[model samples]
Target: MLKLVVCVKAVPDPEKADRIKIDPVTKNLIRQDIPMVLNPIDKFALEAALVLKEEKGAHITVISMGPPDAASIVKECMALGADKGILLSDRAFGGADAFATAFTLASGIKKLEEFDVVFCGMASSDGATEWVGPQIANFLDTPVVTMVKAIEENEDLTWTVRADFDNGYRRVKVQLPCVFTVTRDLNTPRTLSFSGIIKARKKQVDILGLEQLGVDPEKVGAKGSPTIVSDMEITSNTRETTMIQGTLEEKADAVLELLKDFGSIG
Candidate 1:
């Protein structure tokens, strides 16, 4: 049997994007009342793991790092078919940038039994930096393939996959114990079912904190992060509407003149 790990995130609801705000002092998202949901693209990554479990009888462990509420998303993954869920939650783990976040997650992963494969979304909707997956692989000292669209073969210790490239896609054969940051093209995610929810209720979600992982607190949050937002400003967009008065031909000429004045046309 294979052991697989899928990394998931609880991001602020994208539908409520307008309500999102940034903290001027911390340079972090102010998510006081915002509802959090599983990162959309991460569903594809979890789906990939679920498919592998169904085909080859593997155990899938879904892991994430966030506040205590993030366990809700972890349970959602269990309802969707993951075998186990783990959430790394602690106030010390707050305000983590991509590098710090990945480091913390990698430390948590090291506590698990040796895993054969690690899957993650190509990027998170909130940050969209597309760096965590690769950085996790770097910390794990494993080969990484990003933007994976399909898994052509997953037999024995070698697997073949198709990944997005510069303009097209490339096929790659990778060894086991590798990391794959998947794209939505990989597979369609399954929805929750009543039976799955019941099963999830029986399964426990292990919550680990910075001390549990035995990682340096200074290396797992804002203080450990190398990148800092020195300044941020919100720019307002205002549009001016002008009414054209005259015959149809005159209106057309007027619009053309306005376009030229705005540099929208030559």
Candidate 2:
């Protein structure tokens, strides 16, 4: 059976986006009191794995790194048809940038010992850098295909996939033990069901920390992160309504003039 790993993230609820705030000192979003949900695009990645599990008889393990509450998302993945779940939670993992986050995830993935393919979302909803997946591939020394929209062929050790390019799509053939960062266009995710939830109750979610991962303290979180957020601010957008008076010709001219003033037209 093929062994698969799906990486998921617990991001702040998009519905409560207005309530999210950034810390002045840390520059990281203050997640306290805010509800967290699985990253949106990650559902597609998990769906891809689930489809494979159904079609080719594979084992899927879903993993994540976040606070204790993140375990909920991992469990959710199991309810969606994953065989096992793992959560890497620790204080040392806080304030991790894309590179640091990828490093930490790669460390956890390495501990898994064996995997045929690692799937991830193209980007996180909160941090849309689109770097963690490729970075994880780099850390694992595996070839990575990003923005994967479809898996054209999946057989044995070799696979063909269609990925998004600048204007069109490109078909890529990669070997097993590779990483794929999938897009929402890949597949439609299945919803949670009662039977699946009951089955997930029997499956265990193993929570690991820095010690469990055996990663350096200075190399897993903010300390090891190279990128720094120097400044961040929220800007408010306000709109004003202007009424143009006169005939149709006059109104047309006025609109054109306004567009020219705003540099919307030459």
Worst 10 residues of 2 by lDDT: 230-239
| Regions of candidate 2 where Cα sits further than 4 Å from its true position | 236-241, 256-266
TM per candidate: 0.91, 0.94
lDDT by residue (tens digit), candidate 2, 89-125: 9999988999999999999999986999999999998
> What is candidate 1's lDDT per residue for 123-149, written digit by digit as tens?
998988899999999999999999999
Candidate No. with top lDDT: 2
The global C-alpha lDDT for each of the candidates, from Candidate 1 onward, is: 0.93, 0.94
| Top TM-score prediction, candidate number | 2
Counted clashes in each candidate structure: 0, 0
